[model samples]
Target: MRLLIIAPEQIPVPPPVGGSVENCIYQIAKQIKGNHEVTIVSLYRKHLPRTTRVGRATIIRVDGGSKSNYLRNAIKQVKGNRYDLIQIDNRPSFIRAMKQAFPNTPISVFMHSMTFVSKPVTTPSKAALDLGRANLIIGNSQSLKRTLGSKFPAQKHKVKYVHLGVDLKKFHPSGKSGAKPFHILFAGRLIPRKGIPVLLKAVQIARRSVPSIRLSIAGGTGKPAYKAYLRQTAKSLGIPVTFTGGLSRRQMPVFYRTGSCFVCPSQKHEAFGLVNVEAMASGLPVIASKIGGIPEVVQHGRNGYLVGAYHRPEAFASQIVKLAKQPELTKRLARQARIDAVQRFSWTQTASKLTRIYEGHLNRRQG
Candidate 1:
């Protein structure tokens, strides 16, 4: 099968830093390249070539001054290429044009989050029309599928969920565990929805019991004001915190190594907590909110604990303290977390499942 994966014209494929959606496209393409002929079309990056071969798959980068130009260039690049399947990542707007370009092909829109499917980015009716056009619609988690279904019931039957994965080998633990100066790690974009302020408060409260506890947030703060506010909030709360800025994908393992435990105190519902999976793969137990798809991965008392009253800092802090006070329990949970990641969530498995879905659409078309 020949698969053409179109990444949003924003980030380059195999990007240097945290490009969750871009990285997912590359990882899935790489894993399935052996069995299926794959080609990834992404925006041009200065450091990367216009066309390059990685393993058996091909990557084609196009000019991307803006979304429309990037889309036009990408369509121009793959104008006459024969593909068994075409996958568009995170862009509902591309669906109409892509369908017009490849009228005979099966096009699927893979949503990494709800960002593109709702207002501000797109209107309900427009998103509905675009998504309804796809042969298949995929979400990264059941929580996301359910949520989207609630909003767009007419297209619910077309929507399916596939959990994103982690590279187990790259993120494996260093076989080291320490609790002397316990580190609480949070990894994600520094958005208000991520609940970083709540994390700061949680750390402040947890410090009373675990005085050695400190916080490290490893992500880029896109806005200067938000960065300043976070720092000021941490300082005011008397919490010792370090904003590690943004670390590249290569640097993530080292950041994971510095943590005693990972926390995902999101104020809103998550689609699929990919960062939590990465932390778990790195052998750091997760303490995250019970809402959304998080509970599906964290599994209270197994790999990590899930806080019910997620918005309350005290709820998160209590879980943080639980892990802090019981070093042996922490190590046990950490070990199991790694086991869960390896057994359940791996790039190879993610590729296989996604391939099965693609083939399903293909077979139906043939019939």
Candidate 2:
């Protein structure tokens, strides 16, 4: 089968800068490419080649401007290619044009987040129409699927949930011994929605119980004011917080391996928390908020603990304190997290299931 994936225009495919959606596109394409002919279209970078082939897949980067330009260029580049399936990532702006370009082709629109990151796709009527044109609609989590279904009941039947996957081999336990067992890690954009402030407060509370507790935050900061506020807050609270700006995919493994636990204290609803799975894969116990699709990933006292109430510092602090105190419990959770990651959330499983989805749709189209 020949497949083409239309990705977001802002992020590069293969993710040199590091984005979950970009990583997802690359990983899925890489995994499925062995069995199918895959091609990806993403934002062009001056430093990278315009077109390149990785494994069995081809990547084409185009110069981007407005969403209109992206849509036009994407359709132009992919015009002559005979693809078995077309998958558009997140942006609804490309949908109408792509559908027109490949009239008979089966197109699947994947929604990785709750809302569009692009301004053009945020328009309700246009987004609705663009969404309606897809042959199938896929959400990264069931939580997101529910939200989408509720918002656009007409497309409910088309909506399906396909949980994101992590690269197990790349993210596995280091097996390296003797590191700081109380080191907490948070990786994501330094934004209000990520619940960074909440995490800082939780760390302050946790340190009262476990004095050795520390936090290492890794992610890019678009809002300088917010970043400065976080630093000042950490200082005032006297919580030892280290902010390592924007780690690439390569740098993430080291951070994961070094940290004792992963905390994703997101105040806003996460479509699916990829960090939880990544941490679990790295053999670190995860402590995430019990909201959105996070609960779907981290089971309370099973693989990891979930902070029940939204942004409750004490609740998160208590979990950290418990983990610090009970080495045996932490070991159990970490071990289970690794096992679960391998069994349930590897890229292999994701690829296989996605293959079924594609094949099922293709067969129906043929019949």
Candidate with top lDDT is 1
**What are the Cα lDDT values of the candidates?**
0.90, 0.87
User: 9-34 in candidate 2: lDDT tens per residue?
Assistant: 88789887667898998998888845
RMSD of each candidate relative to the true structure: 1.0, 1.7
Q: How many clashes does each candidate structure show, in the order listed? A: 0, 1
TM-score of each predicted structure versus truth:
0.98, 0.96
Tens-digit per-residue lDDT, 1-367, candidate 1:
8999999887899888988999998888788845689889998989888898877589999999989999999999998989999999999889999999999998888988898988899999999999988888889999998988888899898888888899988998877644368889999999899999989999999999989998999998678899899999998898899999999999998899888999999888888989999999999999998878898799999999998998899999999999899899999999999999999999888888999998887898789
RMSD of 1: 1.0
Report lDDT (Cα) of residue 120, candidate 1: 92
Between which residue pairs do clashes occur in model 1?
A: none
